[model samples]
Target: MPPKAEYIELKKSIDTLIEEVATVKEQQKTIMALVEQLDQTQADNLEKDKKIAILENRVADLEQYTRINDVIITGLSIKPRSYARAVTPENGGEPAELDVTSTERQVAAFMQSKDIQLDCNNIEACLPLPKRGTNGKPSVVLRFVNRKHKIALLKQGRKLKGTNVYMNDHLTKRNADIARKARELRREKKIQQAWTANCKVFIKLNGTPENTKVLVIRNIEELNEYDV
Candidate 1:
């Protein structure tokens, strides 16, 4: 071939290679930018997950604090007030519906009967909780004027062991479920005892006095961690 034609073909081949190299470099830059963006997104998602976990823990703490002054009394039947009933003709009166009294009075009287000595004035509110099923009596949820009053009532609750009534802390649904699981663990001999205080479930594992494990249940996963 002629020298000039060969030089022209070589120059064209060099230019094409340079263009392909530039295109490849551009693609590499684009790929690097995308990788950096994906890395940042992953970091942001991890940080967000951490923040969400922290917020959830804070919310759980706040929920527990709100229940500090609450207590539940179960198996306390509502008693009829002793008073003269007015005869009425609203489809034959029937003792005027047992002369219903204020809930505070009823709760105070019930606690007094149980020897808990709770003052009516110290009770902030009292109401009957909805019955769970068809048979058992509805429980009474009582809010006290202060945490100390609630604590005192709980401390005195042990006296009602042989009686027909029982008392417990007013726990949130999550804590209540945890407490139930803890109790189940105790019944299965996985723990010595399970109890709730201040809306937290506690477990006592069987061990020597020095090694006896007492754990506060913050999540259900903790139950699976126990070797028992």
Candidate 2:
């Protein structure tokens, strides 16, 4: 081959090799940058996953508590009950007598254990007044079922031993009170148009002590005959 021609061919081959090396280096740099970005994204996602797990656990606990507690009413009074005790009490304390038609001590015990309270704010009608017949003498006649039990305990009375009982806005009261007030405002048809304060039920778990929500009813009969 001629020297000039051979030299030209060699120069062309060297230029092609140099261009290939440059292209390889550029590709390597791009790959490294993508790898770093992927690592950062994975770390961010992992952190978000951890936070999501914590939130889910909190939600689960709250849902569990709200499911077990409820409120209901019958006649002119209110009662509360919890399903925590079920049909048995294995504790050493005096066994609670189960009542099928009334809210018994079992409801009280369950509320105490769970730190739940029941308020009668949902009862709207006034206490039944004694009636007089044509004889102008007071006649003793029971007007409501379980009237004797309700009167003796005065569970329907609004005069309670509360610090801010008359206060229009009191949030520190028991959860039941808050719910009852909410219900009252709801029954009066003053939910959205009215300026009703936030009446919410706060719940605390046994050990974790977290606040949650519960629904308020008029009496235990709402759950069952003896749920109060």
Candidate 3:
């Protein structure tokens, strides 16, 4: 081969290699840009999720506050008022609405019969809850003017145990589900004891001290963490 021809061919090969390197660099830059964009989107999504979780917690807290000083009386039989015949909200509140005076009078009367005194005036609001009752009755939820009134009534609530009247803390929907699951776990012998107070569910493992650390369960997933 001639020296000039060989030199020209070598130079052409070097130029082709440099062009290929430049193309690879461009592709690399494009890929890096895409990766950066994806990273930014993920960070924004995480921030949004964090904010949503915070708002949800705040909502849950507010719901908890509403039921903190309330009690659910499951078997207190409250008759449908005369409005049951025919009544509208415009004319008057429905039969199912909160008849504060009627509820207070009936509750006070019932308590009087039980020999357990509950001042009707201490009741802030009383209405049937949106839950079905045992034996085709209605479950009533009552709120007290003071937390002390609620606490005192709960202490005396035990006297009405066999009277088919049951009273307990009014729990929010989420806490009620958690409490129900916790009770089921206790019944299955998965835990020593489970009870709800102030809409909070607590469980105790076998051989744990009654006064020791009572495990608070927030969700059903937390139940799996228990060794029991």
Off by over 4 Å in 3: 1-7, 82-101, 132-137, 206-212
Clashes of 3: 0
Q: Please give the range of 10 consecutive residues that has the lowest summed lDDT in model 1.
A: 91-100
The better-scoring model by TM-score among 1 and 3 is: 3
| Per-residue lDDT over 55-165 for candidate 1, one digit per residue giving the tens place of the 0 to 100 score | 987898799788789998888876544555666788486546444576667877777877777876788888887778899776888998898888888899887988778
TM-score of each: 0.73, 0.32, 0.75
**lDDT string, candidate 2, 1-228, tens digits:** 899999999999999999999999999999999999999999999999989977864664464334222222222222433333334446556455554433434323433443434233322222222333554322111222332333333333243333121212212223344455545444554431122122233222112225332333332233232111
The most accurate candidate by TM-score is 3
Q: In model 1, how large is the Cα lDDT of residue 96?
A: 64
| Model 2 lDDT-worst window of ten | 163-172
Model 3 C-alpha RMSD to native: 6.2
Candidate 3: clashing pairs of residues:
none
Clashes (N, CA, C under 3 Å) per candidate: 0, 7, 0
